[model samples]
Every structure is written in C-alpha cells, then in structure tokens.
Target: MNELTPDVFDALIGQDFVVTNDDGAKITMSLTAVSRFETGAPATDIDGNPLRAVGFQLTLRGPAQPLLATQAYPVDIPGIGVHHLLMSAFEAGRTAVNYDIVFA
Candidate 1:
C-alpha cells in the first residue's frame, strides 16, 4: 500500500483544498490557481535543466469517477487511504520540468 506520512499529507493539504469522493477519487478545488508556496521548485526536462510553466494533475486508479459534492462514500477503507495525483512544476527561459505524485 502507498501510505502517506503525516508530513507528506500536510504538504498536499497546504497546497490546496482537496475534495474527494468515496470511490477513491479526488480533485484539487483550487486548480484555477496554483499554490505559490506549497508547490515545489520548477520542473526540469530529461536533460536535468529547469523549464518554464508549472501545473499539477490529479489521478485515480480506477475508471470510476468521483462522487458528487453532495454524495459521500459508504465506508472508508482502513489502512489504505490517500489517492495519488501528478504534480508538475516549471519555469520560463528553461528546458527542464519537475513532476511528483501527491496524495489526498
């Protein structure tokens, strides 16, 4: 199981307000604006250099979509929690990009 420690969990929550569904699906509510502080350094290309433009993506394991805001999961899975999301960062006048997986 990919378990996230408290520190790691805190990092994502600090980045944005996350809304998740019972089926293990989640989305970053503040997607319109990236967090200047929580988001890490700029991303780099394959050559290991910095690049321009920065953003992140939220991912799910299954085909099932997330529940509506009004809906709720019937039960919470013990032990296994926190879904994975792709986080990307970049800067201008560069060719490198950085990416990471955040949990919610």
Candidate 2:
C-alpha cells in the first residue's frame, strides 16, 4: 500500500491520484502540489479542536475537463483518511488546470 506519509507525498509528486467526488464520480489527476508545511504540525479546526493540517495540489493535465468547486472531493490516498478537498484556488497553465487543496 502507498501510505500517506511525507515520503509518499514526495513520491506522489507528478504521479496520478484518484479523486472521488460526493456522487462517487472518480477522476485521475496528477499530484503536482508540494506540501507547504511539515507534517504533524499543530493546528486548530473549525470546532477549535486540535489537529494536524496537510496541504497538496492536484493538477488536471492536458485537455482535462474543468472541475467545479461546487463540492469537496474525497481523494483516495492510503492511510490519508477521508480527504475532502475544497477547491482553494484555480491555476491555469498552458495545458493543465491546477487546483489548490487543503485538508486536515
């Protein structure tokens, strides 16, 4: 299993990741974003509960269809646990659309 460790995150760069939406729709995209902060950093959630936050970006490559931010995407990553990504930002390249995602 490809565990969702920091090492795995490094290996995931430029690799394909399967993201499933609420309606169970799945799409394959490249993991193009680097983790901005180190893993296991202390943080607070909306409920003021303590937790760790991790960030990553997904790049929908060449001629890929646009994904609307109408809902959050539950990305399937081993050991990552229920990753729901909100479309944080939109970045358009010459051939790809990068979506900024923040998950805890």
lDDT of 1 by residue, 1-104 (tens): 22434433334443443445445554443222223223454576688875433323332122122223323222222234444333333222233222233332
lDDT digits (tens) for residues 1-104 of candidate 2:
22344455666677666777556777667777555554575687678876656544334332235454546667665446556656543666656667666443
TM for candidate 2 is 0.55
Model 1, poorest ten-residue lDDT window? 58-67
| Candidate 1 displacement at residue 37 in angstroms | 27
Q: Per-residue lDDT for 12 in model 1? A: 43
What is candidate 1's local distance difference test score?
A: 0.34
lDDT of predicted model 2: 0.57
lDDT of each: 0.34, 0.57
